[model samples]
Target: MSEAVARHWRSGHVDVEFLPVGAGSYHWRASTPKRPPLFVTVDDLDRKPFLGADADTVYARLRSALETARALRQSGMEFVVAPIEGRDGNVLSRIGRRYALAVYPYLGEPRAFGNALTAEERVALKAMLVRLHAAPKAVASLPRSVPAEVPFRRELELALDSVNTAWEDDQYSRAARPLLAANAAAIRGWLERFDELVRISSADNVDVVITHGEPHSGNIVRSGTHFALVDWDTVGLAPRERDLWLVGGGEPQLCELYRLRWRLDDLSSSVRVLLSPHDPDGDPERALRVLRISIEREPFTRD
Candidate 1:
């Protein structure tokens, strides 16, 4: 076990044995003698730097997660794996200014979405989202300051420029260069359509709600026969469509439950996928193949 994990476990006052597991961030399955096993995730501040330069942001995110979890539990949803407070009563324990450790009671292996979800599972997921959107005000108020709203035209322009620069400057590996070059035109066309869709959605005043940000299959876990949502780091107030898009968009069942009238164009989602930065650590060949399929398979239309 690393020093940070040791320090955090000691501070939490839990006699647990840490077993290292997983890729991406450092994760451990913490087994204790008297208490239930816990899942501990440690983010290296120097590497991720998601909190920016402010320690306050970290505190706010932790508090927001705890508040959201409590609200969900009180609402009779016991699946959210809320953060466990350390001995110092803080969800986030700063370890030597290099790592932040947050702990939660363990949930078993995450349900893989490699295959299509069952109809019953989809219904359950939709119900969970509805309850989450209706969480109490105290939970909604805990997120960090809302980001300034920027026009989609400006945002797309900036992203287009950045993507072009990355390709032209050879910022990515040689294997990725050919793929990016081949799809440049398709990528740009998609962005233009996306910008227009955003304009329409904004003018229509789409409903906003506290969202899980990314509720895709990987983030949803199975606890016994029930399901739970994990990774509250990106939890915040945003367009209800953000989460809906990830879950099935405009499906009659979801629309009836959420009472959503406006349907986001498919291109709107494609733009998001295209704008996402390439993973620095991912396999270049596989990443390129995925990118090509994502752009070419979608019909590029303009208004």
Candidate 2:
């Protein structure tokens, strides 16, 4: 990994240290004598979020997404902490067939996931999101648009339908089948409500903009005087609510629509992981926990 960074970034004698931080991706902090310290991110393109996308396809879209972010940052949007381009000018570099790499200026300011947002932070984040929503470059450059339906929705349906059958794929899949069966009815109702929300929101003319799809505290940080956002991997052209719902200050119905969108995305992805063969590096257990909570928790219940 250090060799790859040095080769691509043209930095000599990189010192790479693994940082176990984000879910579904590998991170490292790399330093060199010639340039400032950099943050490195590597992802397995064949799993979870990129399951259906082959390496080349995911690479193209991710490169475009990060480029959009770079454009936003260059536009003087201080909150956009975009990717640092490689020597070849592409935003991402292929790491064999299964993985890809990207680099960024190391912020070294990671906020803990699930930490409660203070009132001041909430206000600042809301204002930052408002500025992001109005940026025209995001709409013009985004390669992928936020889908109206929850991600992994089809896989979730298949899991629910196959819950009664024995899953011989693996121990985790076998265990997951029964658990899914127990909550099949409630899960179906949740999907129906999600679709209903989609119908209602679709009828209203909501402005679509570049969204930092997961703008939770873990992704937003205080950069000097401004609150900057990181993790531009999920950036896309979407409704303002796609980002706003998490931060509050939006309409109750719209916020609830997206809040449900978030959970359903979580539940569906977890179910898909358990139903199929997946990476076991703490992912299966995490998926199981998300599946368990998602099924038991009532819809519209705030955490």
Candidate 3:
């Protein structure tokens, strides 16, 4: 935990202690006087092997993530726990070199909202999505540090690039490549049909909110009947569907409810098969696709 804090910022500050709160990457619990204690989970950019194709890419991603979250905070999106200057509010902090930390007000351990979430809990999640996808303020420009959403694409792109370089050869080609290829082909078809999807998404009247970029249940905290989202690292401009994609995938009934309530034509099956958490074989194919498409897609959208 201390190591995690050291990754983004200098560990010199007192009163800021990091406790282990979860698994896979840099998850933690932090505390300070200004804000209540809170739990946080972040992708570790400091892992020895590194998260990107090269050290340079990893640095780019980490720096950009910090800058982007800071930018989002400027736009009034507070659902995310960010790492920025000052210990102000419930946001995370960025100190030292790459260490980014935040205090969440300590709402207890993280838990799934579960299958039987009350209407209010569901509404909270949806409302959180609304806040996330709300239009960026006029001056909320994107960071030039790391790849943007279009450049980042989906997560699959990482796998593709790694395999191409043989860095991800052992696990990728043997397990994940084929599934990703099929999904990639499907998404290409979907892109050709993107206009239709966009029309449906628009007509659905659902808020095209900017999102946490990655809003798996793991990033959510539930207390009684209420739920709150954390982790601002992946925040970006996107459809509300981005938030629901994983939620619906986890609960088929919720996906159905989403379809009926929002009138979505079809959610991406590729997103499902590729991003599934329970994918035992590992989602190599989708990873490759994400890296590929990220590079192929334009850098950012023009208003």
Candidate 4:
């Protein structure tokens, strides 16, 4: 993989040392002479396409993000970390048949927003969201908003089926079976409420904008003295609430400050927690514990 990355970097006439950085994606720190270090990410385009977007869709989204980032920076917002064009003038390069690569100037360590964000950081983040939301629609058009509860309901059904099937014969299910039975009532109630919320939100025609999608603190990096957002993979148009929910988690003051016109009452943070994907190969006992806690502590209620 490093060799492939080196070859790709040579195409741009950039001589740099690639050092493996961290997990999640194939990340590396590229050191170059006469320029700041660059952070490069290479991944299997076939297996891990950007946010499950097809090639054409992924390219269009990246192009739009790059354009928006440049425009935002030119408008005196230096904190926007846009992708740099390769020697071929493309923001993303197709490597072989299975791989795609993108490069950005290395930003410093990401800020950890543990538990809650500080008042000053919240103000800075709010300012950034205002600028992003106000930017002109750079992408041709945004993707249609799918109801969040659709997948949640599907997964809940699958989980219920799995638990039922396991109870029939699997020894591993012994630990989780009782827990599942205990929470069966609560799970069903949450599912019904989730379905209703989805129906209500889906029926409303809401305004959309180019959102950072997942703009939590982990994605916000502090480079030099300023903060810039990374991971444009999820960049697309959706209700401002999509991004606002990440920052405020339904906090009224922050949402109002951002001037969000859409209501987030239906989209609780617990929905994501409840519908989190489970690994088939993972430990069943551990998974049961997680599900138990998540369902027990869920904030949803039949009000």
Best by lDDT: 2
Give the least accurate 10-residue stretch of model 4, judged by summed lDDT. Answer: 260-269
The superposed Cα distance between candidate 3 and the true structure at residue 186, in angstroms, equals 9.1
Which RMSD values do the candidates have, in order?
6.6, 2.8, 10.2, 6.5
Candidate with more favorable, higher TM-score: 2 or 4: 2
State which candidate has the highest TM-score: 2
What is the C-alpha lDDT profile of model 4 across 1-303, one tens digit per residue? 445444654333454455554323466667655767677877554333333446555455555555556555556667778777666666677666556677778775434432345565567777788777776543324333322423234444555556555433444446555655666676666556545554444545655666776566666776767667777665666556657864554434323322221212212222222334243423444444444445553332211
Model 2 scores what on Cα lDDT? 0.77
TM-score of each: 0.69, 0.88, 0.47, 0.68
Report lDDT (Cα) of residue 168, candidate 1: 27
Error of 2 at 112 (Å): 3.4
Tens digits of per-residue lDDT for model 3, 72-124 = 65676655555545333323444454444443345676653213444555567
Better of 2 and 4 by lDDT: 2
Model 2 lDDT tens row, 80-182: 8888888888788888888889998888846667676778788888888888878875345654776656778898998888777777577777767888888
Give candidate 1 misplaced runs (Cα > 4 Å).
1-24, 46-67, 74-76, 111-116, 144-172, 249-303
Candidate 4: RMSD to truth: 6.5
Model 4 Cα displacement at 163 (Å)?
1.6
The lDDT of model 1 is 0.54
